[model samples]
Target: MSGKFLPTARFLLIVSLLSSALAVTPSAGAQAEPALQTHDVPVAGGPSGEAAQRLADRLGRSHTAGIYLDRTEHRFVITATDERTAEAVENAGAIPRRVTYDTAYLDSIKKRLDTNFKTPGTMWGIDVLANRVVVRADSTVGKKDFAALKKFLAPYGSAARVIRVGGKTERTSSAINGGDYIENGVVSCSYGFTVRKKTDPTYKAILTAGHCTITSGTDWRKSDGTYIGYTTGHNFSNGNDFGLIRAYNSSVTYYGNVEAEGGTAQDISYSRDSRLYETVCASGYKSKYACNSVGLKNQTINYTDGSQVTGMDVAFICRDHGDSGGPLFAGDAALGLLSGSNNSACYSYYQPVNEALAWYGMEVF
Candidate 1:
């Protein structure tokens, strides 16, 4: 079911129920934070989280601009433009708050900035909670460029906010690695989700980081240097960093499961859009499977080397080298592909799996 069909009240009840069901004990290694307070709402069950996400997407497509799942309250809080939109949200069983800027306007602001300022150290995207477009510049943003960007966006007024993000964002690529390692020469990276072309289900391919494929014609190999496939499609620039490897060995088996930290495999049933405050897990060669809470959505990251990637999601999950191209999942749903991380490895960004699938016309196996 899509988000449009869920009643706001029923959605909250369902969320509350699911949250209770899936509540996990904090792993000893998990850094604990204070629990967020919940809204005073009666709990009940109605739809799944995926259904709530669909409703959110539907609202997002309408006059409503932004939506975030309040995990503590077990409900979605929506931002709308008018009384009519608010009423509509109430009718759909969501909590609606009136906001001045809709998502379209915020997205337009981002587009305009992208067109006017190709500054390498800066990135911008819609921040749903603030109901505004947020532009972040890393330490590498020179004084001249930062000032120029500020001047360019000044006319946008309060519609945008510029902030400084510490450390440089760089592509996560190095040797280490276990989601089944794929090696090219001496370089090693983890395999992402296995996929099949929409037009030919029998045609198998593996998804990975495009930066890993920068050296064209480099045949991908197994850990022992056995031939596996070659990089078929890649896009490390122009806003995305995903690559596809067409596997020649039809006998190569890829299950719809992710190997967790303890060698157990978790089944992947589907793919869904990520929401703020939601719990997610990642599996990489270096870090294995680690679960963490998602903190941001629709973010843009600027690399120190001057490359910029937009439409990314961030989480307070640990990652390291050889983690790029790994999978980021929520329950059984595929969410994103590991892209890059900040200087601390404590936080990482992902390329949404939906975008990559749409771009490649492929589906997870």
Candidate 2:
């Protein structure tokens, strides 16, 4: 988004999910709690701090998010709506920490965005709100620099005092402009590390959804920007978008639709998406909260502006694009693949990550 400072549903959803089953409710043995203002706590947006950083990236500044600060640890937190955003924030030199938010707050944010900001810049359904900071072009303002834009936003919100976020401009036509830059936009794939398929020290070839492919001719690699393999096969625009390319020499690994908490792993991978009813969780790159999940799996899903999305896919409390190809596990069984979500750009959907693997002859952990 160009410039806008507004909270969103992404905040509430993440807060609800994290504060719910995840955060260890202040234990009985915990220290006495202090009296607090339920509404005044300065809550940062999203679970991952990427939202803030992305805004900064676009604005050409540094803004960190995910501050779980209080009396205990005074350190700032960064929440990336997805793994890539998380990585980007970290790479950009911000201190990142995973986080979530309250549902009521999220609900209120949605209502607020409608009421506030007469004009929005862009909408990604994440940390940053998409509203225009400059209503008049009296003085030329370039979209490339946010510092000037932040000056415009200071009156509404503390652009300086608050966390900043980064954003990427939409890529223009690469097909027609035949300049000499070597080529095509990259189709990338990133998968949640599977547990079953990996050991402590050995490198494992992880499987991922194929829609994320950069095409068959390109090679695949780790997020660190190293080559690992290539797209041997892929499918997209349907219940497809799966791909398989084994590690050149590493052992293939698997991860059940579950997660590791402290010392325990929960099996979240659903065998049949048709039966999904209860609140399911999803994660994506809002550039704010890293892996933010929302409750309530909405039915009658839509896409690309209310186009009906067919078949059964998983929906979480919240998530977004850039989080695509991420794993969507129910407990520890590897449920689905993070595809697209209907709830604006803030939420996301996933194909069965395991199924994508299976089609390519890759095994799930």
Candidate 3:
């Protein structure tokens, strides 16, 4: 069964069907907010309002100040500032599981290769139950990667399974987290950009997490810039944590890459046709910077907010607040921007850059 050859189209169709069958009882307002493509599946058991409070105490705010759950999967994801915190969260039993490749649940890559399709390294799974995707990517991925995804679902069930990008698939990373990195702001990192008109060097406008704005505005951009605007509007405990940022003027220009070691800007150029398996890196205030491979792209996800974002992707390791609205890329090409993600800290959520540009009326080329 492993080596059997099945038509690519039919393979994806089967997977889609299985995914649909796994739907759980999702929060009604989840769609306009986050991922894990929940609601499609139904969750029967969960803790209630009072029970939720007792559980919160066990979780501990230091390790889970930002943790949450998808109404469907009912799995708690813990947010941490570092790997040590992640471990602590696990030890404390704040999260039912830890983020590790090939540990418990199968990683997305292994799942994709099981099928006859040839997918790039950037392949991941949308946890229809947990309301999140088992994502891990650092760089880029394209159609070839997507083609293999369908065939990977044959053993799950029988139905018309097709893995295609829909309106719900990809989403705008809160630029208050994009790259112009409009990708994740999630599963781990959020991208922040200099959204100034094509003129000034002083970042006139900036993007970040709506949640980030909710507590403090001077977390990341302090001496580098000033406050552009509050999280004028945001979604929380529901869907996406993205918000709009307004500035005095459009002084922000595309510095392009983020400032790496010694204040050097890294080059990033992402395309829809980019490869999946590639070494990639990220820069932000959280871990300073870290590296990983792009295992998948365009996966569906469910955030603690209980919303499902169709096209959001997931990363392997951990990240924190300062890292929110950062950048994820391979070489000079761009991939996704940061967005609100799992409380697990190891999983970074990203939004597609293309969609962010379209929504904000910005350009990346």
Candidate 4:
């Protein structure tokens, strides 16, 4: 972690759960779906997002139960609950599909709906081409709490479904001072990458958004106040959000680049895994650089403060409220952090910079 002047350094874009600004009125002679607006017939080679996450981590998690891409036959469907893992996912190029539910049975029905659903405007993930466990719910979720959440999943029928969707999942903080973002002056978030210490390479750090170092504590400043790092470790909740600041200012200096759009800076170089429809891009201190794709992956997010995270990864891109721990890229790899957003259908949500650099073993700088 060395640098090239951070001066006003900014990063953050967390804001997801559901932010669809209430507009579900289409029943009167509806008719929408002009093929959801075309575009998706571009298949050619397909696997790259680190070679489809190294063929879904070399087909592990009991024979891969998830992997997306398929943008109108672009390729990489994966799923495979058996048939010998769909012949090792079509011999590792990806196209599988088989599915009945694996990936440890949809991660044990998302850990029994994250241990008896906390339900705050609700949320849930794992679609793996619809293998199950969707959930969603919003509009403040109250039809008797969506019918006791469909009678507590009616014992996992069809593995789980539910559905409703339309805004109402919030958690946005702001204070971040340092000319523009990276704040611990109180509660500001976003600044995700510039790490070290795969066994102590003089240990440096920054990766953000485990609810912003558990609600902005663990000292971390920058806008002239200096100080730069501390939250040594963090994980927002059961599904995980991510954190780990540690840098401790060795006279502050850190760079690998990232912060692009106009003021320029991009070069990250490594970190992948997140490839359902590919194309990502994020950077925030209030929705800075934007670009989208990768609609869902692993995902689980269930917050309204009932707090519950889980391998998140969705993207439509929009982010706001100081974009919590920003940076979710594509050009120079490095793939996630922006941990949440919806700002009326902006739909971001992240956390997977190689599983927070392998749960803080760290890397990237």
Candidate 5:
């Protein structure tokens, strides 16, 4: 059931059905079955996004503030801190613009805040387009805490920006569950992509949100309480939120497909870092599947539960309870996992899938 077998399996199934139909003497009274024709699935994330990622990889994160697609022109626009880096970007066939701060500097600012001002109900992320670190405090932040955060960030001047939004942040795991949801006895959460160890192909695991596996050693099950897997590795603190689950039955087949719109399934090819403003799709137990654009990257989110997850990205998509650990992808590329969302659930924050894959030495199957 892995990716290697998907196309072949489909082909064989089609052939078998056709053979069966041919063998059947179509009685004049029997309505003919509708013709079966496979239509090509559309791929997401065009060349513009891939080109920016390649340049960003070559230039490194230190000198590059951000790289995104110019929607109007459909070209890659890269922001570089120094003239030398800008020249390098130009030479690489991208449009380079000068910016005051590099991603490294913005990351440093985030670190400073992470160390000193980890106020709950607040989150911050680098805005590469604005060339500044944008700090956001949701409605849960009291006036006093907001003032304290503002005062602390005052020294950074324009390098740091702060704003307020209208919702509280919360993980989407649910206690009340029905349907085919995955559960860890305590809370129910959505399942993510299936992955295999890079070094050991026989070892398989399921990727999910760290908060879902925060209680390490917990056994996961299906809604009916059947055994599914167990938490092997989970990271819910220090601005990270991803977890791994070793499959209970290693010999069982697991496909690389995710439920897409209209009850269809899309095969996941690989994982990659997300580009700002690029549209991606998410699938979960609650929300099913939906597509939306990326809002920000390298974000630090401080949940109202006194927990924090850094290196998150914000999306314009909406999610519901039990959507935690869902998959966010574009085309066949796995991007991130559902982390949490604001109180109103208007937008979502996710942990990049590549980060979890790297940390656990795994790849999507």
Candidate 6:
């Protein structure tokens, strides 16, 4: 959800959430923790990190129970339901733990909840650590809906848990077209990542929040009202929040670096997935450079407006107005695009950059 449409009521909800005991903490141990082995494995959010995630995905598809990143160990921890799968995980260089429910069982539970108990302010997704589906409900979910959700999960018993989070999720659109912001005549947003179409390297484009392009036309401009490009594609409130802007002007520049908080530029070398408990930094017009540790992965956030966004990366990064569609990265590795935040700007969510690039057939250059 975008930050633009948040109302006063939701702002209060954010305050409450922030005060809740469930708020995420920083990862001091994440950096100081000793490595399990002397040999270097891929750091989380690196190429090896991607490989680890893909390996975990394959294991999950093969009905593995759960998978999580052991950041300190620099390896994935997989839960295998059987001896054969445990042996396979050991051979694949992952630490294996025994568990009962496999990915297939967890996925079936999620499907049942989606098909029968779907509610406006409710969402559910796999939580690898718990080996169960985590169901989240926002402030907008009424008692009746929450009750229904509980009843639906009753069959699964301990396989699911419902939790309350602060603030109603909303699309972070509504930046007025003006100087210093990427604009589309009626609205403006922060540029996410500069890219070229995978099929045509010559075609330059910029990625941003898809809701930023919900206006009438695709024409785009810079903050100074300088014409830059047009929206070639966009997706919102339907699984992902990303948009592609194809530049028409040769004079326009696409930088290989992200603007740091103090006006410094940090070069991006590659893109990787966000890891749990890892520190991440975000840059946007309103908040500039803000850093925070990662919280949850594969989170499903329900907005008050009856829209539910799944597979969001939750972080403690602060965000405010006009920060939508900005870059969320960890050092040189690109991670995600700023999607929305709680009212207090204490916490935020991002659409994973890898998924966006794959969906749009584009790559960050």
Cα lDDT tens digits for candidate 4, 191-286:
878878878877778888888788646788765667787777888766777888887876877887788666589888677666765667777766
Cα-based lDDT at residue 19, candidate 4: 26
- Total backbone collisions for each predicted model: 11, 97, 101, 20, 3, 12
Better of 2 and 4 by lDDT: 4
Output the TM-score of candidate 4.
0.35
Tens-digit per-residue lDDT, 165-222, candidate 5: 6667887888786666788878889889999999998788899999899864388886
Evaluated with TM-score, which candidate comes out highest? 5
lDDT of all predictions: 0.70, 0.35, 0.40, 0.67, 0.74, 0.68
Model 6, 205-233: lDDT tens per residue?
88888777756768987777678888888
Off by over 4 Å in 1: 1-62, 175-180, 250-252
Can you tell me which runs of candidate 6 are displaced by over 4 Å?
Answer: 1-47, 57-63, 176-180, 343-347
| Model 2, runs deviating above 4 Å | 1-185, 193-205, 214-217, 249-275, 283-302, 305-309, 342-346, 353-358
Q: Across residues 1-365, which tens digit of lDDT does each residue of candidate 1 receive? A: 11222334644464354233223322323533432222233212322345545555776754777666666456666677788878876676766767777878888888888777767656577766556787767667788888887787788787777766655667777755534578776557778888888899888888888778775446888766668888888888788989898887655666767876577887776676776666778888776777766766777777776777878898767677788888988667788998887634255789999888889999886
How many backbone collisions does model 4 have? 20
For all predicted structures, in order, the TM-scores are 0.80, 0.38, 0.42, 0.35, 0.81, 0.79
Clashes of 6: 12
What RMSD, rounded to one decimal, does every model reach? 7.4, 17.7, 18.5, 19.1, 13.8, 7.8
Candidate 2 on 1-365: residue-level lDDT in tens?
22233233443443454334222222211222321211212223222222332343453212222222221222223443445555665565444433233223333343343243222122212232222111211112235433443453465442212122122111111222221111113643345434223233233344454545534345654444445555555565443545445455344333343333222445443333312222234322231123222222221122322222223343323443444455554333455655454232233445555455555544454
True-vs-predicted CA distance for residue 333, candidate 4, Å: 6.9
- The better-scoring model by TM-score among 3 and 6 is 6
lDDT of 5 at 166: 69
